[model samples]
Target: MIKYCIMILAFIVTGTTSAFAAETAVLQDAVTQTNINYVWTILAAILVFFMQAGFALLEAGFSRSKNAVNIIMKNFMDVGAGGLVFFAVGFALMFGTTAGGWIGTDGFFLTGIEGQDQTWTWAFFIFQAVFAATAATIVSGAVAERTKFTGYLVFSILITGVIYPVFGSWAWGGLFNGSGWLEGLGFIDFAGSTVVHSVGGWAALAGALVVGPRVGKYDDQGNPVHIPGHSLPFAALGVFILWFGWFGFNAGSTTVGDTSIALIAMNTFLAAGAGATFSMIVTWFQFGKPDAPMTINGVLAGLVGITAGCANLSPGFAIITGAIAGIIVVYASEWLETFVDDPVGAIAVHGVCGAWGTLAAGLFDTTAGLFGTQGFDPSIIGVQLLGIAAAFLWTFTVSYILFNIIKSTVGLRVNGELEAKGLDLHEHDNRAYPEFVGSDEFIEGEV
Candidate 1:
């Protein structure tokens, strides 16, 4: 009896120790994963933040040198303004408790979040905040050189604070806790092809239209004219910057530390490569030379095109999607020129390609696509179409109204005199390159 009691006591002690060990291991894993997620998210935010510099350079390069300072100012202001307004007002509208599946009604000023979620909230907000700024900046390129500084700032505030978040609520509100109608319908835009890119694209389209064509962009017969950018090298560098940043933009959407990042990164690379290659080939054949601007835009088009499906697409399909987007961007850029003066092809790269990417997700997603064992879910396609359509219409209409308001109240463009002389001198009272400010060749040719 004594021996048996001793054995039982030993078994109990061992079992308790084992349980304690298991609990400790689980807690350790949880802590480690949380730390890893925090690092990943912050890193991604930094990468996306770098895209601002890329936009500044690209806009400056595409625009005349006289407007370079103005371009830089606009890009800088948009980020500052976007970050603040998005934090104060946009985050709540997007991620708060849902109201009838359309909008968020709570969590304003990031109130009421506590404990575990609070740890996640800060890093996630910054990541998404950068994305909001990105959407706002896309319009800067489309309306470059002539948009009023004040008017542009106002639009940026409204877009990041109200316009972006409302739509974001409908699709991405569920990411944290609240559910959206589109999410209910099973819409999948893993990295926001429609949510970020398309919304920006459509808003850009509206701004470009309301702002009207730039001076000297059309002839007496309304024939299109070519106003060359200041520096192709700068433009190329900007494209490289944006390309590098996009890996973070797409892969980081995973928002966790996991093996999936490898696949996401590879898919993004393949798509960009295919896009650049196709654009080069098409431009060579169509224009009898590989156009530098077209090629750069092609790279961006691919990045935007794959964003929606990056998490879901196979690498081979990513290549196809990106290559098609590259070809489409060339044609879309040319086609849009006939109707509107888009200085930097923002409409093609973001708006048109954004729509295509979102829709392509429905077609190419392995789990829900025609290629899958389930053999094509029409409902997924329907949801994607509805989401894309809704984004385009909502953003364009709101943007048009907002632009008109800005136009009527404060004026949208600089006077023709200011535009011709350049925005740097008239708007900012400074020149980007002071040494060449008044040089004859600089004013007439470089400017």
Candidate 2:
């Protein structure tokens, strides 16, 4: 009887242990969370990809009808060609193993990345690939209607595969190896104001410089001449599309599906609203009209401004940041137009505002901001300035050289005939509006 009782007790304990182990295994599989992250990140990437349509419509609408097809083609090609080049070389340079905290030296052609549940490598690639294309496409607008499609293609490949990725490695290398000097010094740029927008903005400035302004952009006395877009409705629609996509742009940077997404999304909304309101008010008071172009750009400026600290800033601060960005876009656009001929206001909205947003992260960050829990850390501000300076210098100098090279080698600008005739026919042999072909109705100097 004693032996039998001992055996029964052993069986009960063993059975109970086995049941608990099985339940724990089921829970672990259910809550692994990596698969969920992959899905969220991919969805965000899809939204960002939709922004390419926004950019195409925005640039096409802002430009002459004759150049609309060319603009659309360039935007389309950038996504295709830019993605391949970034996947082939840029991703490796950006996210591979680090060398001295400056660059990555592995994963070329995407060879070495592997995992079971952490199969996020591909999803991450798509997200970052869209971002890479965004930086390259910004140049299309600044040099629109005048650039050679072939030359522009080369520029796009180089920017995505080399210039942009190198700088991205400097600031974001930690994502791969925890080995970037800027990150080591606690320099935080939450979503890439400097990384994406400023880099694109500076490159756009360089391209504009190389290609020169569009025909009739400036008069004999060097005063800018107003060249209205073909359709304000299209431009407005593009702005709205961009606004919608930006929620993913900011919130998706979290790289996970979590509660913080709600806060980030709200902050994004507030800043964009503030930016639009303040810019409209400023333009209404200054120009005697609520300028539609400036107002649309102001909304973008606010989006770019708040991107850096969207996760770290409060709703009120986000509004202040965006409102200031809106106001700044007006002044910066006017100021840049005095010398540089940026047709789309890319310089002001992305480059200058991007830098400001990056620095604003230092001032308003809740966790490590100057006024955050740690309180009064001047070093964060210093680091932010350093990051901004580094971004401007690196992006500008390299891009200027690249543009010059492309200009001298394959030629950056089309012939003046092509400029007057419209790139749609000259470059693509296609017309966005075929009915106006061979008619003086769409000519540069005509009504």
Candidate 3:
């Protein structure tokens, strides 16, 4: 009897010890994963943050000499304003607890986000915040010479705080919480094709529509005029900066530093190179000269186009996708100029190419990709179409309403005299180059 009792006690002790060991192991794993996720998330956030510089240079280079300072200011203010607004409410609305499959409810002010597997959630918001800012800045270029600075600031806040987060919630937020229709439909936008680019593109379209054409941009006959930007070197440098940042823009969307990132980075590089190469060739063939601006825009268009499908496609497929995007950007920019006077090609690069990228995801996703691995149905093409339509309708309608409201109440455009005199002098009371001030000959002839 004594021997049997001893044996039973031993068994009980061993079982308890084993349970403790298992619990410790689970906790360790959770902690390690949390740390790893934090590091990767922060890194991606930094990369996306650097993209603001790329945007600043791009917009400054694209605008006329009279609007350089104004462009730079708009870019600077957008980052500041958008970042604050997004942190305050946008993050919650985008990634918080769900509502009726449309918006998020919980997480307001990032409250109670601790100890949760919120690494992905935080990183996603930061990266997406930069993209929202990018979209807002695109309109700055389109309305560079004409928009009121205060009015533009208000628009940026509304977009980042409400417009962008609302639509973004529909796609990524819904997917994160497992209630999104997109997941049920097997829709895959590994990054933000419709989420980021399309949202921005639609907003740009609305702003351009409301702001009207720049002075002398269209003749009385409605023919478009050529308003060349003042600085090609600046523009070229801006393109290079944007290209460099796009590595982070596309590859960083993976949100993790794993072997998959290697594939994504390779695909991104191939697409961008193919875009620039194809655009250069197309320009030489079609326009009788290799246009520098077209080449730059082509690269951007390709980058934007491939962003949706970067992780899903092979390098070769990326090249083809990017090349087509490059060609489309060239023609689309010209075509849009006829109807909407987007001075900086935002409509072409972000709008038209953004649509192409979202659709391309449906075409190029393969068995090796995320969709195939998950046994998601092949009806993703139709789902992608739905996402595109939803993005277009929601973004256009909301943005148009906001812009019209702003126009009727506060007015959207500056006076023509202020536009011709330049916003640096009239809006801010400072000149980017003070030496040239008070000289009409330099203002009229040199510019």
Evaluated against the true structure, the overall lDDT of model 2 is 0.87
Please provide, for model 1 over 1-447, each residue's C-alpha lDDT reduced to its tens digit, 9 standing for 90 to 100: 999999999999999999999999999999999899899989999999998899888888988888888889888877898889988889888988888998877776777753337868888899999999999999998999888988999999999999999999899988875678888888989888899999999999999999999888999998899988888888889989999999899989989988899988988898888888898899999889988898899898889999999988988899999999999999999999998888888999999999998988889988878686567888888899999999998999999999999999988988776788888887898888887753212364444
Which digits, one per residue and each the tens of the lDDT, describe model 2 over residues 1-447?
Answer: 999999999999999999999999999876767667778888889888999998988888888788899899889888999999999999988877888888888777777754312356778888999999989999889988889999999999999999899989888877754256777788778788999999999999998998898778899999999888787788889889989999889999988888899989998898888889899999999979998899999889999999998998988889989999999999999999988888788999999999989988889988767668877778889999999999889999999999999999998888777777888877887788876654423464452
- What lDDT tens digits, residue by residue, belong to model 3 across residues 76-153? 888898888988888777766668767877676667654346556666667767877776776677667788888888
lDDT of 1 at 258: 85
What TM-score, computed on C-alpha atoms, does each candidate reach?
A: 0.97, 0.93, 0.88
lDDT of each: 0.88, 0.87, 0.78
- Pick the TM-score winner: 1
Better of 2 and 3 by lDDT: 2
Candidate 1 ranges with C-alpha deviation above 4 Å: 114-116, 438-447
Best by lDDT: 1
